[model samples]
Target: MKSAILQEADAEQFAEAGFAVLPGLYAPAELAALLRTVEQAPVSGPNFRRSQEVFAIRDMVGAVPALWPLLDTAALRQLLGQLFPTGCQLVKAIYFDKPAGSNWLVAWHQDLMINVSQRTDQPGFGPWTSKPEGVSVQPPVAVLENVVTLRLHLDDCDATNGALKVVPGSHRRGVVPAAAIAELTPEATVCAVPAGGVMLMKPLLLHASNRSTGNRPRRVMHLEFASVELPAGLAWREGKRLMM
Candidate 1:
């Protein structure tokens, strides 16, 4: 059952499973506002990807300032407080949609890269890659460990509609080599989230999704939060610098 309040057990579950789902984080009105804002986003832009199966805005926070009103709320703050008692900042945001009839399939992988403002020759950070989205680099394991990703669904999602399949405790293994993902995963559980639900997870968790077998649109706003300070001379991409 989903709770309107974020309880301590939610934090405990997340600590153990590396993921937790809080259903109905957004009310009807809030979700409607978000959908309306999404309709205004540019159909084609540098940060937008409109493939046959997938449509995504890599920098939703920067591209659409109207999203903040719908995203920032007391409920969100409560959830964040339970997980990060000290503090945390929203470091990244991406919005993606799996349209009906979409055949897009994502392979099992850990989100090990982070978007940063500059390429600092830090001792541990390296293997930088630049994309239209932003400059990305694989930070230290500790930095990735500190990341909290909140996936808010704009439509109902289930195993039939490209819901995420995750390895329960894989995050504890630290960063797994991408080259060794042949097994995809030994075991997995489908993360079924309702429309307006929010699923929180660790960036290190092993996750993948299959092509949608059902005819439902799956849209999500992927938000990443972190409190750790990047090594000197590094900062998050623009619009992710705010504390929420």
Candidate 2:
């Protein structure tokens, strides 16, 4: 089995490319349990969205409380510990799934906004917006650089099944202007991951996905972790912290 610990090479890859994919992070039964929990989660939350093309929960672990216990598994903790030796707070979690024949497509963009509990007078933090999830604001560039995202795949992902496409080292340029993102790259690497694998990436990574051309579902749990605390009175919306 592939080790959950981030190796030296993996760390370098993340430092240079801003993303890395680790396959076979979960066992078959573990993946099954996650899918079952999500399937049974009540669809009665403001963050829940269901349509012909996609199923998503913005405040995922909050909406499905049962998911908290499931996520406390030892394997995940090991991986988190390697990244954040002291500890890391789970700032956000999202459940997203693209069903077979679903025409769901996402454009290349950086995850610059963060969902916070309330608006506070914090210098360098601005461009606030309200959404069903919570109050999302674009924090300082330093904050965005420290945000790490782990995408847990519940199904196989590939070029034909809407796998993510990311521009290598695009994050090194810092927050690229919206108009400059399109010019960031015409070259990207397809990050294919098997079921139960995890894709680790920085929040500033330029990533996108194409509509599925294959007949397979792509279900993923997107979890964000922050190693630093917010300034001012601002708090993470979820405030769900996990450690080994």
Candidate 3:
């Protein structure tokens, strides 16, 4: 757990840059242990082709007691509270493994929608109605506002292993114009971090990753949090809440 003063500083950084990196958030041995647990999980079917190699563990706080220490860590809790003061709950947990030779490349886009469990034409639910086999729709602004993402690096991430690239202060703009983006400079700041470090980002921030050009694999644990209440009769599938 970090001190209150450190947590405040982290929150400020997140607000200014739309992201923050906390080094040594986890010990090397702790990270290695979680990585092993992730490796043992069953992989989804072939249709799960979103990322080159990815897996998800819902309610991970219950699955791995080791991670509970992280959740209870004062710094993390303060950051979460600062982001979602109302009381946020874990929405979903994902593991991304960018293997050598993987050609996966993510585009610059905002996490606009969240597919809840069962879909409805609820007020803040989506432009889409039902949850496709593996696809989900975007959630309303209320939901988006309550969300914060934590990405933990399991290996030393640099430009070679497809470290995340983000547009500084981009989150201040509600949405980016495609044509404007096309005309903008290609400059992007790389988020480089060593193993056991963590990156905290806003869901609306513009970010992406490229294919791994390095020999080693890049692994990350992405977790989302939301503080708002779920709609009536709807439950969050994984971290996705069902809207009424």
**Runs in model 3 with CA error above 4 Å?**
5-7, 44-82, 129-135, 184-187, 239-244
lDDT of 3 by residue, 117-158 (tens): 675556756576442333366776667766778888888998
Best lDDT among the predictions, by candidate number: 2
Error of 2 at 64 (Å): 0.7
Pairing residues by index, what is the TM-score of model 3? 0.79
* Superposition error at 3 for model 3 (Å): 1.2
RMSD (Å) per prediction: 2.4, 1.7, 4.5
Model 1: what TM-score?
0.93
Off by over 4 Å in 1: 1-4, 179-184, 239-244
Collision pairs in model 3:
88-227, 91-239, 113-138, 113-139, 114-138, 114-139
Clashing pairs in 1: none
Clashes of each: 0, 0, 6
Better of 1 and 2 by TM-score: 2
Give lDDT tens digits, candidate 2, residues 1-244: 6555677898899999999888877888889999999999877769899999999988888888888788777878888888888998899999999998888799999888999999886899999998766798999999998888999999999988899999999988888888988777686889999998999999989999999999999999999998889986999888777755
Model 1 C-alpha lDDT per residue in residues 1-244, reported as the tens digit of each score: 4453666787788889999998988887888899989988777778888888788887787888888877988888877776677888888888999998788799898999988997878888878998766699999999999999999999999999999999987889887887766554877899999999999899889999999998999999999988888866898875344443
Root-mean-square deviation of Cα positions for candidate 2 versus the true structure, in angstroms: 1.7
Rank by lDDT (best first)? 2, 1, 3
Error of 1 at 58 (Å): 1.1
